[model samples]
Target: MSPTAAPTLRVERSLLRAGHGLVAGVDEVGRGALAGPVSVGVLVVGPHTPAAPRGLRDSKLLTPAAREALVPALRDWAAAWAVGHAEPAEIDALGITAALRLAGRRALAQLAEPPAAVLLDGSHDWLSDPPGQALPGLGEPVLPCAAPPVTTRVKADTTCAAVAGASVLAKTARDALMARRHEEHPHYGWAANKGYGAPEHLAAVAEHGRCSQHRLSWRLPAAALPPAPRGARAADTLQPPVGPGPGRGARGA
Candidate 1:
């Protein structure tokens, strides 16, 4: 399907027909960001689900205003929805692939019940456990319930309405998070760049060194980073939230 075309429930409906009573569409945001948490969104739709509201598409195609505008409609349309995040520290401790799975599992855990099956946007099933390679203390059976069957589709965010809705929810929540964090570290311009490696962001990292929000394990720019100012929280001291709410009270969306 064309990227600009409105997403349809054709794929989700097919899953319903195949006997999956509750199908969850899954997508993630901020996976490539230089700071802040990686977020995953799950939007569950059943056979009774209605058509998506107008103007819905992949989150990347929508303006910030447009994505924020659709939040209410998207929430109303889905049987259930939730967004989950894995902090930068978690990303640095576990690899990005494992961090994505961690975030995805957290999202799935917020649902009223586990989905019968999951429709993931990308080709890789980053939502599932790594089989025998599970990391100690952080991996192996991290899923809240038994892992649901997953079906990965390339470009599912553009072609599948449910997955597209998931992307929208995830993007809005994560963007709001970065915007709020911008208040604490305005030099990085996270409010504008959303923690992606914008030129100004890279320059700030070079000048001021990494902050508590930056993923320390990532290959950051090679520059002499100064020590944190006196009384400033160290980058490694921040802790991840134990809950699924992605700072809902601070949401700018």
Candidate 2:
């Protein structure tokens, strides 16, 4: 069940108190899905705006209809927001970690200006390069960030408004793409399964074989694969979004 007031701006407030004037929240969607590009969302919020509605929760906690309903409200509430995706080919070319970093870079590039700090949704900062081989004298992990300083908060999507907003943005954006993919491959039930390896989707894959949109690197089920029609790729159909959304976090978050 969806809870009331799931996400708060407490993290933003703390950062604001710490002299970070501009703080953006970052979240990603579709990480584990067997198909579709991974998407990242960035949301920059202002302190003066009204508090997000009490029902704003991680996107997974909300229904698809509920999540779609919140996109307009989230756009109205956020100061600035943008979404980015690393397409299926990119995911195969680069590792998921690197592809996520690429998506985040694309998101940050859309921002009007650099944020003073970033509130990443998870404790593990995927935007950063992993620690170099641990040196004997230096016992510290030198994780390198691709963007500004980040304060990684575990479950931030459920506990922080900005992060929740980011989560919603990513979730909605990815869902829309999957919905479009559903149009091309209706048998896969992407509209319902959102390109996840749901029973229906897996069954379709088993029957019709995987398509061009499927991640080639993943240990997919053995099936008679076919090429996705050379129609409009979902990424090509993306239009600039108004702002962002608020509802759930990944798993659709």
Clashes of each: 0, 8
Q: Residues 56-155, candidate 2: write the lDDT tens digits.
A: 7788778888888888888888878889888777677665667777787778778787678899977677775557721121222532225788889888
TM-score of each: 0.85, 0.79
Instruction: List the candidate 1 regions with Cα displacement exceeding 4 Å.
Output: 134-143, 222-253
| Model 1 CA lDDT for position 242 | 20
**Candidate 1 structure quality by residue, lDDT tens digits, 1-253:** 7668999999999999999999999999988787999999999999999998899999999999999999999999999999999898888777677777778878888888788999998777877776785534555365444359999998999999999999999999999999999999999999999998788887898788889899876665433244446887665444342212232211111
User: Which residue runs does candidate 2 get wrong by more than 4 Å?
Assistant: 1-5, 131-146, 222-253
Clash-forming residue pairs, model 2: 5-54, 58-248, 58-249, 59-247, 59-248, 59-249, 249-253, 250-253
**lDDT of prediction 1:** 0.83
The stretch of ten residues in a row with the least summed lDDT in candidate 1 is: 244-253
